[model samples]
Target: MKPIMKISPCILLLLSSFASLTSALTLTVGDKTSVCAATSLIVDGVLDYYQGTTYGGTIGLFKDPYYWWEAGEAFGGMIDNWYFCENDTYEDLIYSALMNQRGSDKDYIPSNQSLTEGNDDQSFWGFAVLEAMERNFTNPPSDQPGWLALAQAVYNTIWARWDTANCGGGLRWQIFTWNKGYDYKNTISNASLFFIASRLARYTSNDTYAQTAEEVYDWLTETSGFVVSSNDTTNAYTVYDGAGISGNCSDLSTGEWTYNYGILMAGCAYMYNHTSDTKWETELEKYVNGISIFYNTSNNNIIYERQCQQSGSCTNDQRSFKSIFSRCLGQTAILAPQHQSDIMKVIEASAAGAAQSCSGGSDGHTCGLNWGYGGWDGWYGLGEQISALEIIQNTLVLQYDAPLTNETGGTSEGDTEAGLDTNDVTNVNEITVSQKDKVSAAIVTTVTLVTFLGLSVWMVL
Candidate 1:
């Protein structure tokens, strides 16, 4: 008869620890469900639902009724969630948002509001669509004048408006607005252009996109004076806010935000991957290091907008900044694996903190703005939910073993397994599992043999 084997107390304790660590590192199905529920709540509560004769869509301009730029940001977050979860529930909703909100022509105008010409705003929607194309979420098929076409159209619009007359060669903050700051050439707008150009360059294998990325980078660093070189070589370059009417790049606003650094970081990473240019590598490293300035000292790694986040006075625009930063940072990590460890440390820490801040609400879970505080601050909005969802999804992306394959069938080079393999039982204390299943079987067999030998000796005695 075969003898029964038993696991020792020591082995049991080791397995417990191993399981705990794995659970801590990996997101559970429950967590994903909660995040998805929160997303649905945000969409249902905040977005304006209008059913037209031709089509219907959800408007994300909850804060500013007419401002479709914010809608673009919300839509971007939704796309990220869709990619991470791979749920087709929001697929039609996304398509509706893009089709209904955009202009009739290929212009990609977000809304019909007059003087709504914020180049950055248009670029945000375009960039989101570009991401959709890359993820294979676009309806019309990426190859045949689909999301890629929309993204390129937006790029062309921005390219056409390039102001050599203003800050030398940077895009303006607003394309055509009676509002102030139209003349202001901010770092975000130009960095967005740089990011789009670099990504487009990679996707199309076109030299023009690469050249355009370089042009934007040079204009920001050298011409616009946004990038301030450090005295020490090891220290990465410092980027400042954009210039105003004076058009002097050196006349910086000095208000540092995470998204600005993140955009350029991603752009440089893509450029490096596409061109194998060491300069882009250097720039990527600089921006990665440059993001440290936004990290809260007391918090483990919760990023904050240095300008008003400390005082809890972050505006609607400021509230959504960290998510953008987090998304781009994840992209950079994928493009450049060498920096993954350090980048993951920051990302994991922030995710942990953000997850802790979710308090029960009408939707079961609503996240707040200040994750560093580790508690809900009595505020909730679409922007807050979007930011939390981004961080959570980014954490999943980082934790997953396999590269994420979106609906479109395209896969990233860094894709691997979905999560840690539990079958391989190695040393639980050290968490070293080399052929874990085989090792576990061996341990069980040896223990059973030892028990059987002890029983035989007792019987003989």
Candidate 2:
């Protein structure tokens, strides 16, 4: 049965958002009340599509067509909304959702979703915890693992899959051997590991994390050739989809994405901030420039998925890419201030267009995918809500504080070995076995031995 959704009343909702969220979202850029109201409505749209499995859904995920990983991505954006908008209307729900999904291993790889998990899928939660850490979202109690530790847990386990044995070195798209894309070393997966490492290095002041980020960049540039465009006229280089190790990562998939360049840009910006290295600064500039391919000039520089959006063929997952990229673009701009004006020009235009697109769906505020299509593109879902919310909220990014570090006021705990003891070790290609199964095997072995001994004795008699 299709679950009937209800519109959340906006009484005493987010700041100055007393207006009902069931109406179209009208925004006045640079006005706090308007931005707050707009984000509040979009956030409501976000929750409307997600009841979480615990809230009476199927299999611990968001609404139909959304993968489990997108839940993490949506919450990560919600945390950003919490940071920028200062609305805790759904704080408890968000926190509980994150904690509940923090698998027994606390590595974002829950037993239910582990069968088809990918490196990028796992890293979505890693990105979420990293967002919590950077945003200083409410920390866990004293004895519980903190957000920083959880992010590291994801990093430790994910980086463990760095397959040096194939195509020199890189992370495969899928984690398990049986999953379909295990042989494909995709950019989003590798970029995720790099993004996490660079973010961690900045937070923990750890040179080791920075080194890993560098090695990841080196592998993509040298081994995979996915980082540098085959036909580069400018210093710009688009991050292609990725390559299969079947051809030694030489036969590139060549699908460019907003998140690929955006993730790399943010990671490089973090690297530049952490080390003050000009090389990282150079990389940052190139990546930021590379993102230009995603924006259409005729559409007044509004971003779109060049590979799929033109044909209106984007998947549910692809629909959410802009939100992640928008968040990262804001981070990159703030960290690399030289690019702030340029980045905001693009973001601000898209924000206005996105606001206009929110006048869709039954509630009249559900966001649409085609920001440049003038008004509503008629698309509405968790992905559109997330992409719109993040872009809208992040227009206020400059007014906020920069991401914190351990040397700064960050209070999140750390555990370098968080995932080391878990049963879901990435190196082990087999499915995880529980302790109960081990005990059952032992009992069966003992009973079989006794039966064999009795049969031998009877034959002897």
Question: Which digits, one per residue and each the tens of the lDDT, describe model 1 over residues 97-181?
Answer: 7776666454565334324547678777877777776776656633334666667766766776677766678877876544357
| Each model's lDDT | 0.64, 0.82
Clashing pairs in 2: none
lDDT at residue 418 of model 2 (Cα atoms): 86
Any runs in candidate 2 off by more than 4 Å, and if so which? 1-22, 53-55, 58-60, 229-233, 423-426, 433-461
Per-residue accuracy of model 2 over 1-461 as CA lDDT, tens digit each: 21112122331133123223457789887577788899998887877767563456643368654778999899999898888888988788788888888887788888666556899999999999999998889998978899999999998888888888888999999986656788899999999999999999999998889889989989887678888853666678768898888978889998888999899999999999999999998888888778888785778988888888888788788989998999998898789999999999888889999999887655667677889977666565677889998888888989877899988889899998888766444444335756675577568658866975786566445
TM-score of 2: 0.87
How many residue pairs clash (N, CA or C atoms closer than 3 angstroms) in each of the candidate models, in the order given? 9, 0
Number of the top TM-score candidate: 2
Minimal lDDT window, size 10, model 2: 3-12
Among these predicted structures, which one has the highest lDDT?
A: 2
